[model samples]
Target: MTVSDQTLSTAGTEVADGIVLTDVAASKVRSLLEQEGRTDLQLRVAVQPGGCSGLRYQLFFDERALDGDIVKKFGGVGVVVDRMSAPYLTGAVIDFTDTIEKQGFTIDNPNAQNSCACGDSFH
Candidate 1:
């Protein structure tokens, strides 16, 4: 696969398959990594089977460089997506939202036709 040609004027939200990491989310990820006192780990995003929808997302810190990984950087934080998940996550935006209702990382996936109630899974 190739990196998407589309890009936003705001900042470094551009990446392979059009997956974007917003500035706020990048800062949060940097803070979380700093708290752990390690720079070796990179944020890894993957799609796995399960959840109410056909696919579920998995986000975690990882150091291994899996084959065919799509790598990108946002505010010094590294984000990795596996080859298989890249297509599903194309044009997706990863953001951090904090409000009275909720606070945490969020994925805005354009590819998903519909998502479950919790919003943890999509198809």
Candidate 2:
């Protein structure tokens, strides 16, 4: 189903299901792609283990999708999540923020039963 136009910003973009891309995040990603001079790259989100909280978040730019990947498109951007990471990321919202103390992409995940104090890891 198409998202309601009223829920979108002036850019005519709608936030994805359980996900969001703040204006700051979208601009940052766009700038990065421009600087890299590669228009084919897309953001890939994944879950891995290595943090004190038991699970860690992984974000990267990739040009191709591997087997068993779930793909979602938002505002002309492609987001890919692998099979293993799907459950953990379900109902998660992704946003970008630029505050005096922090500046980067952030994920608001409802599925996290526990998270590290630094907010970099989850369980």
Best by TM-score: 1
Q: What lDDT does the true structure give each of the candidates? A: 0.83, 0.74
- Most accurate candidate by lDDT: 1
**lDDT of the structure predicted as candidate 2:** 0.74
What digit string (tens of lDDT, one per residue) describes model 1 on residues 1-123?
A: 122334443664545457888888889999999999989998998999988998998999998888888877777788888899889888898999999999989998889999999888888
Encode model 2's per-residue lDDT on 1-123: one tens digit a residue: 121222345453345544555565666777887899988887889999979899999999998868887766655566777878888887787777778998888998999999999898999
* Model 2, C-alpha of 90: deviation from truth (Å): 1.0
Off by over 4 Å in 2: 1-18
What TM-score quantifies how close candidate 2 is to the native fold? 0.81
TM-score of each: 0.88, 0.81
